[model samples]
Target chain A: MANSIPAPRAEGLHYLGLRDDIARRIATGLLGPGDRLPAERRLQADLGIARGTIREGLFQLEAEGAIYRRDRSGWYVSPPPVVYDPTRWEGFISYVEAQGRRPATETISAELIVADPLLAGVFGRPVGAPLYRIRRRRYVDDRAVLVERIVIDAALAPDLLSHSLDQSLTDILKSVYGLSVARNQVSMRPCALTGEDAAALGVKSGLPGLHVQRLSHDAGGRVIEFDHEYWRHDAVRIDVDIRVR
Target chain B: MANSIPAPRAEGLHYLGLRDDIARRIATGLLGPGDRLPAERRLQADLGIARGTIREGLFQLEAEGAIYRRDRSGWYVSPPPVVYDPTRWEGFISYVEAQGRRPATETISAELIVADPLLAGVFGRPVGAPLYRIRRRRYVDDRAVLVERIVIDAALAPDLLSHSLDQSLTDILKSVYGLSVARNQVSMRPCALTGEDAAALGVKSGLPGLHVQRLSHDAGGRVIEFDHEYWRHDAVRIDVDIRVR
Candidate 1:
């Protein structure tokens, strides 16, 4: 690993060189995920580099999602990003467990809400129609990673709110309503965390996150579920394979 | 237009009401994209709210991708996010143009570099193989939005670097090299902006962005292009539709 580090030279590129060195350490498992990096002063003294240069390199690494910083705890290596393939449609639990990580979900709230215009539009129901609204906090290996709000049209399954709300909604739709997700319209954007989402994810407000919304339909082309998910950006990678026809 | 603004009421949801008011203004074209909002003090006075309340509303708008703030400049309504569909494989120009925005590209650098082991592994070639390296800055309606670094296997197209690189490489491969992209393996993650990427996109370093990479294979199953794209997270929305079989 020592041989892998480039010889320090050229003042302008020192930060980039240092970034590559730290990246190599992460790749070689010398620095594992959630492991705190040596303090800035320690790194500066050990590498004989200026503190500013070290910070610059660390900033580059942060931008690359290789590490993350807490407000006062300095920096830690980021967890291995969870691979998300929307085409699979197995939901969060299956995906996390497939990655060899334990998955858990907490039902924050489940209640009946009058459908708003957005909900009415998605579910093709009249405004003020009754609907089941479920809010959940999802975890991967005990780390709260996502907060989701799911709305289900009560006409499809009138007793949905009475059942377990912490499990996969897809599974519930299949078993309870005899409806399987036939297609999904998934869209994603990056945004700062709102106060509510930031609190749920236990991150600072205004931190960047990925906001994903999925409107799923059943075999009869009826909308089954509309879900909004806020994910900590550092913890997930979305993968897709496209075949050009 | 005044009727469109919701009445300011409720103790805890004042900021949310303010957010909705501003959002309606943007929707009605009263405040277009890139149009700056009033100063914090001015907004506080105009809305009869505390400075903290005004800040909270602006932060909510930012989190929703409805607005963005510069370092010294006050907030501005964000442009409608550019919709990106990787499955279309229409390349950047077509996608941007389809969204009714002007698409432009600047060739930052084009040269030949010796492929390292990583590049060699992707291209199934030996290390030190000659590769065409091209870096480009992309723009939407004159706003620089993305920076891309693409490496093409030069052995497949000996004279690749001699032509223009300001257009889509997918087109170039088909027209100049008689090779068309057959498939793509695309992965995306939320990341902060690296220094070089930040300078190109005119954003602060370590601000959130989306990092996407594509490894494209030709009709013969040979890797043709390895491309890395760093996009300002606020400027684009990724959409994918999947049909379950």
Candidate 2:
């Protein structure tokens, strides 16, 4: 890559508190994980300094895990990422709310569909078991964000279809069926939006999206429910509370 | 969000297999998050079905956390999300690989700049620390992507600017300083790109981006590094992995 050097600042590798400069860059959002630095020759020429000073600065940043250099790809920007603690099984709604963003939903088309092999496995019923389904679009303000369809065990939630679901299903289960979801898992992957989804959300197809799959269990370890959350890339942040091992 | 009904499949809901249909919509890019499904009344009219049947179909989909519904504005897509396990400390190289995507980097700009107070506090160094600042750009493929820079820990990484690097600094620490990182706290917030970031990523400012901040610690619990990763809104996906209690 060609150098896009701007007005030369202080040049030279002489150790005049270089570590603080590097540390400062990180604090102010300059350097990130997975970024690369220029060759030593160029750096020395531009900074007008010895190599030792730079090495010392890097050593400290490295110790902190602020930057990581691959075998060949150079240094990179590591986004502040949230950790998923498997021991905490709250649903997606709770996850968003935990981050202090309001979570809201709209009921879409609700209908019954015949289950297939996979649905059978998730619902834990025979193939072709009668399954109740609801398709809803979720959002943050004007952004028509995630489009999700939920499946229910019709037998388990007989009158579920008639109820207004303005709150959380887990809450509904607790109030109606005396069930408490004790744990859940969320898995995600990079995804692209489709024409139908685009048309529904008024977005163009091929835009990046996050596909989230969640599975929950009750206190007795019974599979409570499983759902997929198709979230827009821009409107959400998943937060995690972590502890050092 | 407008309600775009799920067109009845050629074989109807039974043959389409409720589970497979949802997955296909996501995988084939047919349905997207935030796309509102047709109103139950409209869906029945368009799909030539009873309203009650549509409700049953939607019920199952909601249980899986695939979508969120609002009380008034209709259903929207879930935003890009991830369930991360923070118990283990990791660099970007390992993290991206785990997601089944390749991460790459390039040098952007690097030079010494006067330390500001905020940076000085982060590094635990006195104010106005002279640092060897390095800026780098990162990418997934040919996409002109994220731009990141790092402020070296002026004391430990002496001569870090002297070496040609595009590799993992964690590895460098293991090989050179013998310092190992063991913990970190990462967080993210949604933001618009700055002129500098947007220009580097080939986009205009005011577009959305993920602004992340992290403080990294060492084996002895010393906070050794701080990091910031700002990603273009269109090109990145943050996966949320959760383990629930």
Maximum-lDDT candidate: 1
Estimate, for each residue in B182-215, the C-alpha lDDT of model 2 and write its tens digit. Answer: 7666665545554577677765333445666666
Worst lDDT 10-window in candidate 2 chain A: A1-10
Q: List the residue pairs that clash in candidate 1.
A: none
- Candidate 1, residues B1-245, lDDT tens digits: the string is 12332477454477777887888899999999889999999977776787877787876676567887776767877777799987776899998998899999999999999999999999999999999999999998877788999999999889887788888878878887898888888899988786688888877566578899999997788999999999988789999987777
Return the lDDT, model 1, position B24: 88
Q: For every model in order, what is the iRMS?
A: 2.7, 11.4
Q: Which docking category, incorrect, acceptable, medium or high, applies to candidate 1? A: acceptable
Question: What TM value does the first chain of each candidate achieve?
Answer: 0.83, 0.58
DockQ of each: 0.47, 0.11
Q: Give lDDT tens digits, candidate 1, residues A22-78.
A: 889999999998899998888877777778778878867865778877767788898
Top candidate on DockQ is 1
